[model samples]
Target: MSKVIEIQDSQFNDEVVKANETVLAYFWAPWCGPCRLVSPSVSWVAENYSDRLKVVKLEVDASPDSVATCKVEGVPALRIFKDGNMISSHEGAIGKQGLQDFVESAV
Candidate 1:
């Protein structure tokens, strides 16, 4: 599988909430500066933690339903889901170490 999968509202349930393994959904928007800053770290984590986690990107503007469902008021939201439920979430541009800590703490 790819390091990161671009997710849409229609696939959110089957791909994320019900995923067998832990999933990190990175919710972002095209115009958000913070989102851009956090994107690389998200991808890096995806590649490094391929076994422990799954990273999926969700564009807020295109996925309104998921954006609302996830309660994302801003871009660069990172939510971790396991066993069909959300375990943790962070809403801002976080660095590589911060992202690592975020995932490590949850898993």
Candidate 2:
């Protein structure tokens, strides 16, 4: 099983921005109800799509600077990055199928 990498502000640039592979970042806050609802699907995507995508989890509360830089206005936001640039983003909780589609479309 693949693990969702926990990202912090300090390493945001090195981990996500300059990542060698396509990255899917799940930006969430612990207090957000919707974020909790999307957790499992995020994990599933991490494990299932490990071959082609790099999955990471970022806590908005802990990584404030990174969140601000990403311009994330809400929790449960998913962003896809490739070649050091954000390629796509989705704001809201979604199911496994939706996550698969999100990643597939970006790739």
Candidate 3:
């Protein structure tokens, strides 16, 4: 199976901040149209890069506690982490290609 992770406030530090592998995260609110539209692309990349990366989807509304701690100011934001450090990110729906490119380069 693919290695995309679903993280919550209880597991944020250990699962995300302290992760040994590259973590690719999407911060999206439930009502975001573009987030829904580009979700398939995120899933595709997650599956495609399963061997090299860890993908995650964080529901901003559901995880308000994490949102505040992580300073996630916008919906549909992408954050890339490797070696327990945030390396890159972008706002809005970056589509599959854009996301794939960013994550691929992040590692």
TM-score of each: 0.96, 0.94, 0.89
User: What would you estimate as the lDDT of candidate 3?
Assistant: 0.79
On TM-score, the stronger of 2 and 3 is: 2
lDDT of 2 by residue, 29-87 (tens): 98999998899998888888788888899999999998898889998999999999999
- Assess candidate 1 and give its lDDT: 0.91
How well is each residue in 1-107 modelled by candidate 3, as lDDT tens digits? 54557777777778778888888877887799988877788888888887888788888877888788667887788888888777897887776778878877986
Model 2 Cα RMSD, 1 decimal: 1.1
The clash number for model 1 is 0
lDDT (C-alpha) at residue 25 in model 2: 90
Candidate 3: residue 82 lDDT (0-100):
83
Model 3 is weakest, by summed lDDT over 10 consecutive residues, at 1-10
lDDT comparison, 2 vs 3, better candidate: 2
Which run of 10 residues does model 1 get worst, by summed lDDT?
Answer: 1-10
**Model 3, residue 96: C-alpha shift (Å):** 1.3
Give the Å shift of residue 21 in candidate 3.
Answer: 0.4
lDDT of all predictions: 0.91, 0.90, 0.79
Indicate the TM-score of model 2: 0.94
